[model samples]
Target: MIAAMLKVMVLGVCRDRGALAMAFVLPPLIFVVFAAIFSGTSGTEMRLKVAVVDEVRSDETTRLMDAIANEPSLRMHALANQSQQSLREAVAYGNADVGLIIAGALTQDGEQSPIVIVADAGRSMAGPILSGHVQRLIASQLPGVALRRLIPSVDMLSGGLTSQQRAQLISSTDEMNTADNSKSITVGESGAGLFRMEVLDGRGNVTVSYYAGAVAVMFLLFSAMQGAASLIEERSSGIMDRLAVGAAGTDVVVASKFLFLTLQGLLQVGLIFVIAWIVYDVALLPHLMPWLATTVFASAAAAGLALFMASACTSRQQANTISSFLVLVASAVGGSMVPRFMMPPWLQDIGWLTPNAWAIEAYQGALWRGENTWALLTFLWPLALVAVVSLLCAFALSRYRLRLG
Candidate 1:
């Protein structure tokens, strides 16, 4: 029975170049786009654009600016003669990440003055990182120069302290800073330490993992929908009418489509992961079994869904529209577009209705979260159940529709 279904589907697919292209070409292209967008997030270096305005241009300020410019992480644009207003505008208008203005001289006096930093609230990390580097530079020049003044706002201090109290505070602050500076995290010879771990291991580009699942589920539905078009076409062209009267039953036709789409969906998903492994270096080999299991169940679920949609709709246009709408809505709610963690609690609970939610979760759990095959069955069984129920329903509906016609 399955062989007959496979022969028909294979012949149909081979005859249509467009269908073949969508099945093979589209998935790899989609994976490439996703990999390009997310491949750099987990790199060791953080490249930030910084704008500097040195009004004083003293030896101290020049040295400090030079030091900051030399850092590997920072890409500095020296606005040598530019005003502090220009620096502020640069950061405000997205021209630069963080801006520094050295308007006054770096005095070696006992009192500390604030160094102006131009930043917006949206990027909280850039400001603090820039400030830390600048403080380190200041410390190099003027030893024991209190970095407390580098805090973003003076309002953080509720009241003024006396000179003696302030001196004691500075001493405590200096001791704490020194203590922190003295220690560093490094890999040990045992090979189990933090530094020994691969930067890409377990923590590689999260965006890639997320989009891998998202695109897989999204296109699984698309390919299945496209495959299911055969049903609508056959029905409209009187082929289904002949088949209904012939020895072949409506149940056989539905079963054939379900099997065909399941196989194609599996191929589409497997090709996508292969691209992910080759292009993005995702850890596919270590968790191959879990991934394959997830793919099989996901493909089955998507196939059943496509058959159901095909049977339910009277026209090809209606089937396409309904399938497209359902796929997108499910993808959106199912953590295919956005991570479920970002979604509200109520929406997260509701995502389980969609096959995409289970498939994506299962893939993510196996590939990214290092989940075992058994652990993934929690999601796998539900997906298989959905496929079984949906395929049965589609067969019944197709039989009923054929009889009515």
Candidate 2:
């Protein structure tokens, strides 16, 4: 009996390609993606698109522009003839990462003018990136002056003039004569102050709100997969054929399964946010309506995807293997496991194809960005559409599979 069972087990393994792929192929692929996500930042280059409106038109202002242009990381976009307001708008709407305006003369009678740096709060890195360039330029020209004020979260930084604002004191010293070239760096505070959440990690900092959405979407896929696996179970137990004989037919069976999975997914996702709120202090209650709307659409999408996967596979093992592999791949590419921002431009574009990306984006908008109904719809609609399409495809595929069986 033992020898016969061993023979049967070996034969089963040989027949199931999905099991072989899951055991041997999928693990390495997942490992590769995880490795890339963790170490990829070291190889990734940080590039900032800088929008500039040079109203000063002075030699000193020209020097400042040149200094900015010389930074390897800064890509200067001179918006010649554009107004300062236009520069600010570009950054506000994300057309530009950082906005720079040089208004008035750079210096008059040894008094330096301020260079305003306009940046969006959502792009927190841009502010520091631009500021670092300015700091380097200042150090190169005005050696002894210190950064007077540094504010991280606030929208604006005032370059309030002090009696010793200029590097004139340094100019008095022959070893470091940069007093005359001292310039004040003022940040333009008019950009939209979008809500941002930061979570510290030993490895690095993460946007807590963004990851909250990502993690929710990731687990949602798993929940939907688990719920839809009932289809495979029913088929194995000869229940699917019996259900197909009912009044509403297999269509009702599929719809009921989809509905059940969707509700289950919603509950799973809700619990995720509850944990986020309790532990991470994420503000969800204030935007509960839109958050619920986003969750409904996201859950529907996951449910549809799960049904589609269930219909496409031949057996329980195959469905499990395929669904798990595809879900993990989608999560990795869709900013669930790794941020879309951290991905290469090509991969970022590819991420848009996944429902996970849209779901996460919707959650981010509703939960943290304070986007209203219409704005939330922009992301949610795509997910709803995907859910509809996937359900249709799953229905058709299930019919075909039933006929074959």
- Which structure among the candidates has the greatest lDDT? 2
**What is model 2's C-alpha RMSD?**
8.6
Over the full model, what C-alpha lDDT does candidate 2 score relative to the true structure?
Answer: 0.69
Best by TM-score: 2
lDDT, model 2, position 117: 70
Q: What lDDT tens digits, residue by residue, belong to model 1 across residues 1-405?
A: 999999999998798665665577656755653343233222323456788887778665676677788866667865534887677655643456677766565543223332566654333356656766665554553333334332212224746566776677567645543452433222122211101111112433445765787799899998898898788888888888988878997888889989889889888988888888888877788889999999999999999989988898887866776676678667766768765433433455677888888988788678766677898998899999989998998998888888888
How far is each candidate from the true structure, as Cα RMSD in Å? 17.5, 8.6
- lDDT (tens digit, per residue) of candidate 2 on 229-303: 887787768787887777766677789999998898888888888878777777678778888999999999999
- Cα lDDT computed for each candidate against the true fold: 0.69, 0.69
Clashing pairs in 2: 167-179
TM-score of each: 0.53, 0.70
lDDT of 2 at 8: 94
